[model samples]
Target chain A: MSNLFANQAPLLRTKTAPAAAALIASAGIIYGLVLCCINSLETFAVSFLAVLLAAILALWTFVRMAVKENDRGLLVTGAACMTAIIIVTVMPEGLPASFHVYRSFVAAALIIGLCVATLCSAVYRLLGSTPVAFDNSRYPILILPIVIALISYGMILFVLCLNGLPQISWQLISTPYDPANAALRGILNDILGTFMLMLLTSIISLPVGVGAGIYMSEYGGRIAGIIRFSTMLLRAMPVVVLGLAAYGVARMAYDTAWQGILAPDPTIMIGRGTFLLASAFLSLLVIPVITRATEEGLRSLPRDLREGSLAVGATEGYTLLHVLLPWSLPNILTGLLLGCAEVAGNVTVIVLLCGFGNYGVTPFTEATSLAHFIYKVMFADRSFRMSMGNYVYAVSVILLIITLGLTIVYLVLRNKFAERYRAH
Target chain B: MPATVEIKHLSVSYNGTNVVKDVSFEMPAGKVTAIIGPSGCGKTTLLRSINRLSELTKNCRVQGEIMVDGENVLKMDTVLLRRKVGMVFQQPNPFPKSIKENVLYGIKAAKIKTDHSDIVKSSLQKAVLWEELEHRLNESALNLSIGQQQRLCVARSLAITPEVILMDEPASALDPVSTLKLEESIQSMKGDVTLVIVTHNMQQAKRVADYTAFIYRGELIECNETEKIFANPDRSETRDYLEGKFS
Candidate 1:
């Protein structure tokens, strides 16, 4: 009798383990939803709908598993129990507190019922002549979380754009800020400052990045490995740290300039952030991106192309300039455009190097970009947040438009250039 | 016949492994010399040594002497040596430029002062590609068919007006029809430009080469007039290879 029980125990545990785990996970999800709903009814309703959709999906999975495993009785029992629970939970005319209680009870019952049905099917199969294998029907359930994540992201973007649409106007974008009158405030200075910063960053980073990339890929031997590793590390480094470093360098330069014979007044030349310093820091952030892109672009070319060029008596320098560079122009531009988008949206670098002071398009003056301005208005200033919340969203929309436009252009150009050199 | 290029005890090694070992030969001027061997027998390495292109590979060590026009190629400026001795690769490779630009590329790279159109016309005519591609001179070279691209590469090489042109299995990538056309181009270039071609096809050697050199395992086994090598006295390995007993 003891040996018979031991044999039954192994079979029972193997058959019931997966069903038990799924039951516990589903119950936990239901409990979390109930707690969230108790805190906020609106949030509860949304989470409850999500859970309902998930439950339906689980039921579909069970049905598929049952069919594939040849367990029709278990499928019918699970479907009937789920249908009854859904009907009970959706019933009206109960008090709010009782309805919550009833729903939780129904959810608990449904999970237990499904788990039992799955275990019974598994045990039945395990007791048969064939070896019992877990059903593969649950694989499709893995896509649920990804689907939810995408929908949530799209929903947030849609809500932000919808909220900001009414406040966006040509005048709001084209005019300077009027701090004295809340109704007349605009973002022209921020727009110009962002464009100026991006232009400066591009000027500082493009040539250096491309040159380093070419050298690393072509003639750089052991040193190229070091540079490539360092570039990757720099790309992952925090933007704020880079901004601080740039700030220190600019301050030192300013102090040194003040000691010179032809130095201008320290009050005007120093103490505040300058456009050049901001752009220099931004270049540090973007150079890694451009360098990597350029390296990949150069690496993608067939070795035969370079050999062909060299065999025709073209020098290495001439081959790189006329053959490699021209062929990889689109990839370089895509990298540059991506860098431009980085420059436009970056707030940490700008806030630390270029302050929120309003300035013209001069490299030596303190600049305010759209991102930094939004941060200043939303987080730093109380009065501005209360009065200009819609304006902040309007700036966000414009920033979104610019970055999205650049990304679209990058993708389109990459495809077009890729088509040009695709081997037949 | 005068020798256009001479290899004296030439050996090449990549990393630590020797690929071409102590190969010595002289390619006759104003004629075709074919190097025939099984795959990986170092035929291409021997051909590339004439223009010093093998040195471009990483960790590739070249020893001994390669002389072109009585000057050691290893001691001469590589760019200048390469200008004098051009190469066509196993695969057809054209620059992503217009057809006319592809022909003019070598002329421009050499910094020569000459009329571009005349050189373009004559180079294309020499490769026998002018009649078909003359109307499409402005089109990108990439759009040309594989055979046409191979001819364009030949034209581009000819534009440099090299004293010796080295081809490494130039027809290996082409279909039979294109192979015939390439052979005709090589035949037409005889007595104008000295040619050294590496091929595995014995029939190709018989059809176009004035001299045939058989290399086995990175060593030259025999070098003789194509007729004598094919018909009369030769080593056992050469006979075995020509009769397709073993690669």
Candidate 2:
């Protein structure tokens, strides 16, 4: 018995020692990689080290899973990691280096690819094997890399926004543009015009979108199928195409003799790139999104609820208005907020329909939105480009903040409503 | 009491396949009538046809008359018919709303202007849930247990003051204790509202029903007083069914 114990102790020690050593080595490599990043090493050197670190980590993870755990999730994650590594290593050269100015596009791509690979593996590990349980045991180890990646991405954005912060002041925000001296110019009119456009677009889209959604889900039979199919197709249509269509319609309306009759002063054009027209065009783009969301919300409701309402003698319209709409309010709000965010970022439709030069606040006048202003400053006005580049970024930061705030509100409200209306 | 529901030569078909062939039955007012059968025997179809809910299905065809209170339900406006004859489904399907709101829903839908709190209290009392849920009127109805939700549905239906309440296996989804509670609730509802319930549980039918109707393969085999049906059924099929010879 004493001899057997001695043999088992050595065997256990031998098995654990190698695992401990491999773990310690992996930690050392990760520390070194962080140090290299902090020291601002050459891109090639950093990327090479990243590649090596990735390979080692992949090997360690695979060995741990295969030798110790024998988990099916590990197989999925290992395959994802290996695929990501291969894609990074063999990434084709000669793609336009539009975004990466400090490093070769390939090196940047490699780093991003590696980060993506790690994220994939982490997610797979978290999801667990066959029955698809959320394995909390692997949470810390698997989630760390993903958290780091997300934080780093946010940090980069924060840095860029901070760089643009100093360029913005009360003077830059409150005053109108001074084109004579671009340095003194502010985006006050553009800001007001953007808000006006967004307000009008929301007003035009929300009711119509929600109504269409309800119709498609409830009383719409064969015609509803067509509407749904078309909406999906419209959602996939390019923004530029929508802009062109809007432009065509506006031009046709401007040329019509009815506009002359409607206006006391016939010289004033009614529909040509006007704020209302642009907003209407933007609504066309946004409606599909809102409609689809509303449809999904309605569809998520149990059939029993609808039947229950009907069985209680509620008219179809009454049920839709009182029960279905209230139940799906959160989803509808989410859709509306998402549509607003889309409108805030959109420039193509506005640029084509409402010219970038137009900056006004009234629905009757042509207007330039924040995104359109950025596009104009970046590409059209060569003289203002260098001077207003930081200012453009500032506007972008504001837009980002607004959209992010809306998204946060949507998420909070979604959770609240989801809890309230959760089916048993 | 005069007949509350008279179903005459009622046949229900879905997409050209007949589910309930020509069937006739009369349900007396202020009594519980239980329809018992094996699964897929069209007992539910017959019950749904009384309120014209069977027509909600796509390509469903209904023939003949279902007279409720001397008015043919098929000829009646659907909203009015449904208001007159409320239904509780197999599952405990409470709307995702507050308990108070669920009870008030039917009244509001019917556009009846009355004291909302009084009706809510009375209806909940009828379902025997008011004592338990009195303090939690504002709480979401979905927070209730399955049995509670089913009773809440009963309260919601009663808020409309329907002449007849149809229950489709109302106790099927419940635990035995909840089922007993539900059966008690049903028993208490007698002499106030007419009830026609479809159930698979023979003991439950025997316990709560005044009249028991047996259906087999889209046909009505027998319907009689609950005691007589259980004691000495006239038909061999009914006898075999009572003896649990076939499920």
Candidate 3:
């Protein structure tokens, strides 16, 4: 009996191992597939066909190996595999329903790990265990994290769409929200405020940010380094803190006392939580993005272009205007769009300054964005939330569209510029 | 229209390290002068000094006078100096603009108002690019082949009608065919502009240069007619460099 078992080991290494690997890999794939869409007849039938194919292939390999070797151990191993398969098919109720879900999850995880190991060993054998084979084996492991991240993001977007898509309507977009009347309920004022705020922020920030960026990249002195460090410090500060800082400045500028900042009298006329003040604060958030973008854009330019322009008798200023600035316009625009996106989604500053804005949109009016509107609606009243819960997702969907739209536009413009000015 | 460049007791240093030490030579007007040496021998620095282009390097100091048209280039306004003396680099660096615009960039930036189309035509004709690119003058300069781009760069320099054109290994990045085309362009511009070319290729110097100067270790080793420098060099280093004893 010892001699028979010892002889069977070599046969198992050559024939049985490959068949076992194939069976496990197929089982894992089918388990994952069925888990994706349970209770579907088509998925069950496909998984059944997949298992049947693996079994036929494994049987064919065993018959060939048995014919060539004529070993009794091969028959014994094949009989064991057949018995295991029969038992699994006939006695499917091995656990209760409460235990079934977690049990299958654990089983699926183990099977996936086994499949990975099998593939790695196969690759090692094919490549003779070289370092290249080791490197190749690591690729599947490296891809694991990326796959997890992509699936998580996909599921989040899927949930968002599933909950929010139905709540959006033309009426919900074109009217203003009114607590007194339900028919006039919409986010038009919030949308207009958001657009105006973005525009005002851009107006205040673009020149300063772009100029600072150009000076830092083109000039390169101690002052530029100091400016860069200051911007970095500002960028690191929390947005909520920046809101308080803006409030303090508004009070100082309006000649109001610090204690009266939150509840200034009508006569003080500080325009607290106005779009102008919000944008002024938002510019602090935006300038750094634009500055970094501009600096990066300038730096990415080929040395040849700058030297070529200067060598042709154009001064530093002239070269910047004609060559450097034009070449980096797409980069600057990308920064601007990114800054706009950041401004659009930001509600931290708006929430601290004012809860909600029901007034018409203007630079001096109380400011509220789609993000702020969502926050206000969600936390205002329990009854209100229950009555209009879906509108929160609807506003969330609109905000997502705005930010996503800006990003998509930036990508398209960047690609167009890259194609237009590709270095030869 | 051509002018001679005279370098007198010129020494250049970068961050307290000397690269070109007291090198002195004169490039004659309306002639092609080739400065040849191995890599890091200060041949390019010597050429850049003629146009004050070495000032572009940070921490660089120069203690010498480069005279062109009886004026000291070291003391000249860099913008005006560069306009008077144009340079062509190793790689083709055309602006990302139309062909006509590239040729007219310098003139426009200098605010020299002339007939734009005529200057563009003549400049391209002088660079030997007019025949091929006349119809496509509005096309982007980058779409051209590397050889064509180099010539377009030459045309750009010529559009300003500079007295001298400095070339720093202009054919080093080019394939043999492109190199040949660049050589043809150089030949076409001969006598119209004083051309100072720094190259490592001895055969290229022999082919285009009327005069050749050999430098080694940042010092002028020999200067003579091209044939004399090749056949019977005055310095042992120049002889060894020509005989392939040392790169």
Candidate 4:
């Protein structure tokens, strides 16, 4: 029996052992996170934000003085961003109003003067790093994200304009919205907010993470065990954790101290408390996919492809943009698609951090999203009936249809680009 | 038609391990320059450096100058330089695109709007695929025969109107007839561009190269007029390699 088992071991292969071990390890990790989540251990957003910011500062200094924008920046940025997000989220009560958090859609961008100023300063500092390189022709790849932003902004603006929904800028920011109008407001708010979040952080991370991934595979080689390790660590982090941090710390001081008409005012969003927090948390949950996808896109390319491009006299950046990126577009898109899909399904963080209860914001409001709406229907009580109305199957079908529609669109565009490049 | 490539004191190392050391040579104008040697010879490295392709590798560090047309290609932008210095890879790697697009990629990226019809016809004409593929310009390049795909790649490279064209064992993948056709195509492109080719087949090298540089390990052993190097070689290693004494 031992001899037979030994002989059969070759067929089973040693790889299966590590894979099984990894599966068990991951299951343990997930179980632990879920346990932590279920225990309802309050994680304050401020501490994580502080840690993230400090880590970022120290990392930036190290990169400047030692590593020189080294391969680790992606991991660092991803971690810091995720950490700040998760901490701010999972533990906060007065998340937005107390913390001076202003959820900026397009209109709110004008008030984003402070942010733009900081960005401009960073841009200058960044340009200072490589003064004479002058090879930024591939900067246009960064421009594609702006298309998403513009379309999101444009669509929202067009809709608002079409519906004559005059945005209550100052009133909405500070006042408790009338209960009658809150549902329409919440639905409108959720869709536009999601579009903005997706366009901004999620989209940016896709290129940077995936671009890094491509770079890693092309150059990381057999010796990049450290890179592989850290990437795995970062990708393994839970999303609920990330979202809590972002929501808690950044918006803490600005959280509104609300007073009720019937009683003393509660300190939070006009009427909605947890909904916005949930949205931010969901963003955190989607990072691993983005980073991994980016890595995959970079690594999957053949060595000869890189060599061929370089042999023609294209620089690293140029080769990446023109050669590797174009080829890896589908992969990058896949990563983003998966991330978006995964994020769309999450209700845990939203339930915990955002107000998804009788007293909190309702999905019937314009700012509430389809996912939250579904959750609202599934969980809410009806008159001795399944609280949610009879639109469950239709809503699910719509979600599936939307995903399918997007996938088809992506595949079609990829084929067109490929077709555009194929030679006779 | 005439071009010269000059390499001086070139050293390339990948991850602190020297891959090519003290390599230097020059190819005469308007002639086939073949770098022939055993496996791991720095011939490919030397060819790659001429167009500054060596610099693209992350761990690769190169020290020296490669002069083409009195210009240090390393100092210039590689994208522009690569457009001017075409390369045919060891494997036929046609972009996952259509035949028409592959031929016009360089032209299109050049952002110079010209008559599409004229450009496609002429580019295919130069590659000798115009008649055969005149109807199939819309077909996927990936679906074509390997030999045809390679020539199409050659055509794609030629379409960009590069001054120097480098081929890394272009016919290594083909059968005899395909090899014959490739040789014929090279014959047609002889004086149109400065051709630097790396090949293992001595017969092919003799048939195609006007000047030959025999490299061993990471060093240039001998480079001279192809006839002199073949008939009256200076180095025993070159003779040994030519006569199949040892790789």
Computed on alpha carbons, the lDDT of every model, listed in order, comes to: 0.75, 0.75, 0.77, 0.59
Q: Which residue pairs in candidate 3 collide?
A: none
lDDT of 2 by residue, A1-424 (tens): 3665443211111223223333433443354335434533333434453444554455445546444544344355345546544554555433675423333333443444444443333433334322242344334456656866886888878886887776778987787666666565777777777777778999999998998898898777898898889888878888799777766766666546633221112243333476777788889888988898898889887878888899989998898887788778887888888788878888888776544332346776665677887787767767667656668778877777667787897899888877777655
**After superposition, candidate 1 runs with Cα above 4 Å error:** A1-146, A178-184, A250-271, A381-387, A420-424, B1-3
lDDT (10s digit) by residue, model 3, range A270-308:
545667778888999999999999999999999888889
lDDT at position A200, candidate 1: 90
Top TM-score hit: 3
Per-residue alpha-carbon lDDT of candidate 1 for residues B19-126, written as tens digits (9 for 90 to 100): 999989888789899999999999998888888888878888899998887889989988887888888999999988889988999888878999999999988888
lDDT of 4 by residue, B25-125 (tens): 88766678888987778777777777767666677888888777778877877788887788888898776667887777667666557887787887677
Q: Which portions of model 3 miss their true places by more than 4 Å?
A: A1-115, A122-138, A179-181, A250-271, A381-389
- How far in Å is the alpha carbon of B84 misplaced in model 4? 2.9
Model 3, A151: alpha-carbon shift in Å?
2.3
The regions of model 2 sitting more than 4 angstroms off are A1-152, A178-184, A248-272, A353-360, A382-387, B1-3
TM-score of each: 0.80, 0.81, 0.83, 0.60
lDDT of 4 at B191: 80
